[model samples]
Target: MTAITGALAMAVAMGLGRFFYTPVLPAMMTGLGLGPAEAGWIASANYVGYLLGAVLAAYGWAEGIERKVAISGLVATALLLLAMGVSSNVLVLAIIRFLAGLASAFVMVFTSAIVLSHGLAASKPWVQSSHFGGVGAGITISAAMFGLIILADSGWRTAWIMAAVLAFAGLAVVMRYLPRDIVRTGPARKEPPLAWTPSLAALTIAYGIFGFGYIVTATFLVAIVRVGGGSSLFEAGVWLATGIAAAPSVAYWMPAVRRVGHANVFALGCLVEAIGVAASVLVPLPAGPVIGGILLGGTFIMVTAFGLQLGRQLANESPRRALALMTAAFGTGQILGPVVAGYLADWSGSYTWASLAAAAGLLASGAIVLIYCRPRAA
Candidate 1:
């Protein structure tokens, strides 16, 4: 029950809050007459909010205000999603997305922290990694829901309404299962700020590279497929495949990491994802996106889970601060990815160069991790 509940929270906050935007992007472009640049800017707005929320969480604001903000974020996000159904103004949409991004980050960081403390007390640390599958599950459910809406001939507005309904359902589960009393792992250890460690600085920069590498395809894959003349069902199926592949990635990769070491496995996942990201544009038709989605979905969460674990290992005194630093690095890259890709695509009349550039970034990051982040000899 605890694991299920944690997964549901992530499904709502990260999956629905963050990713539902991917499938819905094409609809909005068609319905709202939004250009690629406009859509990219809106997406970047969300990342900005995410960075702010994560910084607040890291600074210990979450320790006292988390419960209030958690509930408020869930409720507010639901209403904001519903509001999206009624508003077509670009400014309004951007504001709502930004706030929703902020709320989602709060739910993700604080709830995970809360759950981790409980899991630690219960001696069930594995639950921390396992619950991340919720992001994939949420992605699957949202993709299916959007697919059904399109099948019913509904527009972008109805899709937003469906997403809101799904968020509300998840909210009920969260309110019921999330621990009301905050659980403390132990006395907080004092450590220097995250910027002090050379190794951590490298890790932080690598994480940002990953964020840049993946965001382009993650944001625009559906649109790329649509422009390539794929059917709506095909596009949804690609996204669904990504979620399904993602759902079990951590389970599979964790064992590998245990054997080979975190740095090696992490770097390998980056290479795999780079190939997948490039495939979206390099290959053809349903085959391209489908293959790309599988690779993209399967490895991203593994990289994230491993990266955070590595951060905690490095900055044992204050894992939360490490997380904040990582989020800031990652969010900054994400902020840049879409906007740059959008402009590049607009200029080139193709996503080819942009996709290749993202892949190159991932490869470079993998190299950095291999050289700088490798685990020391026992």
Candidate 2:
């Protein structure tokens, strides 16, 4: 029950709150006459809020009230979605996205703390995978909703309203099923501090690189398809493909992790995702986006899970802090990716060069992880 609830929470927070923007972006652009640069700024604003939220979550302030925090974030996310629906101004949208990003990070950090801790206590590690899968599930739902809206000839504003309703529904389920006992209301127990190491540092940097590399495609894939003259249905289908691939990625990659260890699996995922990112723009129409979305959906979340898991192992006693550090690094890269890609797209009139550069970053990220964080012999 906890695992299912956790997945629902993630679907609401990440899939709808964070990424619904991608599918809706094309419509917003068409309706609002937004250039790529403006879109990039709005995306960056959300990442900036995410960064700040990560930093805040690192402080152990929510030690006994993680559930409260997570619930608050969900509420904020739903409200922000509605706020987005009512606003057409660029600055207002950016501000709303920024707040939404903050809410998302809070939900992510707190929910993971809740679900992963429960999984550990129950000796059911698969719970973590289920929790992560919520992201893909949410994305699938968003894509379907947007596709329906497009077919109905409804505008982006309606899409945002629909997102808000979906979020509220998820919130209700989460509130009902997410265990209240997980909250530790007694005095906080002391844990060992995180011991920073060279390998940890390298992993952090690589994680950031992965963030930059993947985000370009994640943010703009739908737009790219639209620009390539694909119909609205095709664009939604591509995004749907991505979500479907993402749904089981963690389970699919677990075997590889056992065989090659976390760092190796992380490195390999990066390489695979890099190919997808480059292919999104470099390859031609239908095949390009389809292959790109599948590979990307197949790898990004798996890599994300491994990266956080590795960070937790390296931190020893301070798993939350480690998670926060990794999130901060990722947020930094995310903040840069869309803005850079957006401006580059505006300047070049295509996403090719920006995407290639992002792919290069992913390659470098893989190399760094493989070289610096390789597993020691048993």
Candidate 3:
């Protein structure tokens, strides 16, 4: 019961915070009078905030700070979104989005580290992964609301406001239920009296690539499909839901992480991601979108889960630095992904090149995982 409670709290914190962005963007543009460039910049600004917030929560405040970080982050994110309701300037909106993004990142880093190190202990991969399944659940909620709610003529801003209301309500729930005594561990033991080995470096670099590749699809997949004989926003919504359905790989990979190790799980997930991306271009149909989204989402979360698992393993149970590196690498990729996709979309007026780039990045991540990370017994 305690574990389930913890997972749900963390899930709401991470899932609700991160999953509602894209759906709300269209409305924001239409009603809020945001230009395309502005919308994109705001999205990217959020990513930047995430990068900074991740850095702070992952390392600088690893001890006695988890609950404070989580609580404060959730509250701040709610406020930032709520504030956008009255803010007039694009500059103010961007700043608020960035801060919201950062708050989400802080909660994510803290909650994820807790789940990985404490909630699931060192033996329960399935538990941790299932917790990640909350992301998909949260996305489903956002998608459903975005689709059903005919908010005011105000467009995306209204949706953002609604999302803010929902998230704030969630924040209240988390505050009421979240545990307080998160035992902060000391400096992690070293695998061989060294923390920054070449393998770790390789893993970090590969994950950076993973971030870049995954975002290309995640940020633009719906648009890409719409371009290539795609269907309505309804169809895109279905595809997104399918992608969410695939988010439980964290649980699926848990046993493998215990039996095989983090490296193999990470490598395997990346390899699958590469396959999914390639398949996306080749089979850009309804079934194709469904398959690709499921595969891609599953693998992506596995990489995320295993990254933490491996960092914990390599750091001799201390994951502060490795986790920080992983978050930064992935966040950097996410920040660049949309820009690269947009550039490609502009240059070719099609999604072929962007999807190709995504495939290439996934392949690169897989290769790195194979070379540097392999599954080991937990």
Per-structure clash totals for the candidates: 0, 0, 12
Q: Please report, as a residue range, the 10-residue window in candidate 2 with the lowest summed lDDT.
A: 181-190
| Sort by lDDT, top down from the best | 2, 1, 3
Specify the poorest-scoring 10-residue window by lDDT in model 3.
185-194
Estimate candidate 1's alpha-carbon lDDT, on a 0 to 1 scale.
0.84
Cα lDDT tens digits, model 3, 125-148, are 455765666666566666666665
lDDT at position 297, candidate 2? 94
Alpha-carbon runs more than 4 Å astray in model 1: 185-195, 376-378
Winner by TM-score between candidate 3 and candidate 2: 2
- Ranking under TM-score, best-scoring first? 2, 1, 3
Q: All candidates' TM-scores?
A: 0.96, 0.97, 0.85
Q: Which is superior by lDDT, 2 or 3?
A: 2
Model 1 lDDT per residue over 1-378, tens place: 777877888888888888889999988998899888899999888888887787777776456566677777788778888988999899989898899888988887777777776778889867876688888888899998988988998988999898999999999988988777457646544335655477778888999999899889989989889888998888888898988998778888878887988888889999999999989999998788888899999998888878887877777777888987788888888889999999998899878888899999999888888888785410
**Candidate with best lDDT:** 2
Q: If both were scored by lDDT, which would come out higher, candidate 1 or candidate 2? A: 2
lDDT of each: 0.84, 0.91, 0.66
Between prediction 1 and prediction 2, the one with superior TM-score is 2
